[model samples]
Target: MKLDFDGIRLQAPFYDETHREWRDSVVRPFIDKEIVPHIEKWEKDGDIPLEVYQRAGEVGLFQTGYSEAYGGVTDGVDIFHALITGEELARPGAGGVAAALTVHSIALPPVINFGSEEMKKKVAPGVIKGTHHISLAITEPSGGSDVGNLKTTAKKDGDHFIINGSKTFITGGLKANWFTTAIRTGGEGIGGISLILIPADAKGVSRSSVGPKQGWICSDTATIYFENVRVPADQIIGKENEGFKIIVNNFNNERIGMAAGAVAYSRVCFEEAASWAKVRKTFGQPLSKHQVIRHKFAEMLRKINSTQAYMDICGWHIKNGTPNAADIAMLKVQATKTMEFCAREAMQIMGGISYVRECKTERIYREVRVMAIGGGSEEIMRDLACRQMEL
Candidate 1:
């Protein structure tokens, strides 16, 4: 049994034959051959080799949901393509690897949508081709998820802006060649913020590993510091002081991808536990024969199916052009909580073996916290949903 809710062939209205073919022929084979075998070493090293991104690019993975002008195949691809990418990537149970490979998803949008033609040509082609690394920098040492209260300041000189601040918990920060960063430019609060692209090698720019994290060990999270980094004035992405709206709109897609990954990860836990239970005999028969174990599987399936359903609905909403921030926010919280539940149950069913590093369940259990916390925390998502509803 595949036992994966996402892979169960639900005939989701959003995904057609092309999407399935891509998932089966391209995404699954790539994960099995490239990711599953070497994930342990990458996790131990705190990063994947740069060539992984290059290989992914060569296979059209990064181009799935982007625009054709900028090296994407968006003529036929839609929101579902992006969702499928996230789901299949999470199948490896290596969220860090997925994050590292797709950091440009969040990082390059501002440039693609709002940057000058020169800026777009300079970065998008290389990024889409998998030869460049780009990441977004918004969370600061002090701000955490409070984008409105960011303290990073950028003072403009004749031809350059002097940046001074630090961002922490930045995924792919150590290896990123360019950063699509948020900084304070006008005054206090969200109205004053602006987005700028800062090269990693700029003078006075420095970064250090955030050190060992609880999960996402394979991701290169870092604490990036800027003392007096000078960025060309034209490097600003979008209009100055109007970047807050961009960030807000960007959160919807980010949360959607996070939710999709969470659901797939839950299914991974289910598959692992189900396979384990079928063979490991207990008192007399297999563990799956036991009532309690069967009940556990039932509960896992319920949550996984519900999450997948919500994910499909949300994808449809996005495709049809709906105001879905509130719905997406709530779905993010729902998906992460479901993932957390499934992971805990899988660990319980597998017993001590789930606690060791050798199993996907073990790595997934460690990774659940980051899923809930990153993109946006569960608490933040709930509050954002309420606020979007004007509650």
Candidate 2:
């Protein structure tokens, strides 16, 4: 729906005529017809049906920035196309549902970028069509951000690798049919890491939902346990022990996408609060009449606009093929902080209504922490940015 206030928008340099058309003709309609109507139900149910993903795929939502060989548009699809989709999806203000539908964006890249032709042939079509759900499994029970310190081990046997480890906080874990998994095949260090594509139904593979948490309630967050799970050696992505770089390469896009989502979510909060202020009376006067309430909206927009600008700049860099990883990290940090601020202010402005599950602002309020922590934590993002700057 129209989630923006007064239809006001700061110019996004990254988007063009094609992007606008896609937003109007593709993204917007898909969300209205498929997502907005069912979001609350999915949230309460704690899982979206697989058919939603299939439908999203049919609408070309999952294939926008991918290759034509794998069901995506071959030409003119770039980072901006992906960002437009991200913004539209986020406008509905359901982070968990977004996560559930787009987890393949993270999971499939490793295959597209590094997997064998056979692997891409087998995996990409199913994922693009939404017949198969895939997820990136990196974080473990022992460590969340410390990729090098992860304890999951993969031992090679005849034509296969037996994996023994667990991944926690896995998005789409419960229903994912494939997982681009991180494992240690060598000594303990960053150099020891490897990426493997594991079949979710492989023997010894089991998963249980992480149950409920602070946010993303509709996303099927889970703990995936692999006890000597055997994956075909051919499923190995990229060079052995060089998986860390592949994962690292995926981060910039992931973080930027997350940042874009956060910014849109922030806008939703701002719009919800501003609309509420017009009708919400305090002391026999509309809340918007109060200078204090007016200032909150101003402050929220300030952050939202600046964050959107920086996010667009990051997207530009990515499109130009000169993406700076650290900059993307900082943008993610900025966007999440902005989202957090707007969610709080929106909640404050909306008062009691913001605390309940019936409103968009309230759902976004609970989802703020996940935006900051997932993809990459704010603390980690800052540190990563500084290190990338060689500070």
How many residue pairs collide in each prediction? 0, 0
- lDDT by residue (224-323, candidate 1, tens digit) is 9999999999999999899899988888888899998998888889989988998989999999999999999889888877888888898898888884
How many clashes would you count in candidate 2? Answer: 0
Off by over 4 Å in 2: 1-6
lDDT of 2 by residue, 62-174 (tens): 88777789886759888988887788888889898889888988999899989999999889999999888899999999988899888999999999999999999999999
lDDT of 2 at 141: 95
Task: Name the 10 consecutive residues with the lowest summed lDDT in model 1.
Answer: 1-10
Number of the top candidate by lDDT?
A: 2
Compute the lDDT for candidate 1.
0.88
Where does candidate 1 clash, by residue pair? none
Candidate 1 regions off by >4 Å? 1-10
